[model samples]
Target: MNNPTSGTPAPDGTAKPLQERCDNLMKRIDLLITIVDRGKGDKIVQALRDSRVTYNLSSVGYGASGLALVDMLGLTSTEKDIIISVVPEERASEILNILLYKFDLDKPDKGIAFILPISGVSGPIALKYISGLQQARP
Candidate 1:
């Protein structure tokens, strides 16, 4: 018999192996981190949503500068917004471009964004939710 879902026949005429089905469902995930001046977290989150990202966390942060000038200018600890988002590796480049060009992250003081490969996740359910394969629970 053949596997109706994958349209591929099992070698021994049995249900397709779990490994084969899992291979097709798994996708590499990356962590996209963005830091911008205060009050920009909401905008960044919206941008990620527009790009089809399903998981993101935003938090407030403070920037510490060692320069004396910064202290004199009262800017040693500047308020910032830190946005961490989970995105698929395949879409990393496209989203980075959006941040660079659309958000002007390439310029000084505009903001900064980068991607880090995620080695593992909790399980398939978490992976599917983060990768946008399934809707998040209300």
Candidate 2:
């Protein structure tokens, strides 16, 4: 009997190993973090949604730097909106470009956005959810 959990068969008629498929999927996952001025979290989250990101979290944060130089340079703000998002690695660059150009994150005090490699996830269920594969399954 064909196992549903097994990887799909290749052109040569041999099934690709499930572990290999899972590893590939995991490798394609990445974390995107964007820090913006207070009250801008919604815009950032909306951008992620428009980019097809399925999962994201946002929270308020305060700049911890107390250096006089930072204050003098107008480089710090007391209130910040931190947004954490899950995105496919292949689309990470494209999304970042959107944030950079559209949001002006490259300009000082506008905001900062970056991508981090996700080494692992809790389990397949979580992985599928983050990867948006769960929605593909009926």
Best by TM-score, which number?
Answer: 1
- Report residue 56 deviation for candidate 2 (angstroms): 0.6
Residue 120, candidate 2: alpha-carbon lDDT = 76
* Number of clashing pairs per prediction, in order: 0, 0
RMSD of every prediction: 6.4, 6.3
Query: How do the residues 10-127 of candidate 2 rate in per-residue lDDT, one tens digit apiece?
Result: 5476666777665545546889999888999999889888877879899999865568888888876779999999887888999899989889887767888899999779876688
* C-alpha TM-scores of all predictions: 0.77, 0.73
In candidate 2, residue 118 scores what lDDT? Answer: 91
lDDT of each: 0.81, 0.80
After superposition, candidate 1 runs with Cα above 4 Å error: 1-24, 135-138
lDDT of 1 by residue, 1-138 (tens): 333336556557877576665554566789999998899889988888988887999999986645778778896548899999998888899999988888888777788999999988987768888877675322
Reference-based lDDT, residue 93, model 1: 92
Q: Which TM-score value belongs to model 1?
A: 0.77
Q: Candidate 2 clash total?
A: 0
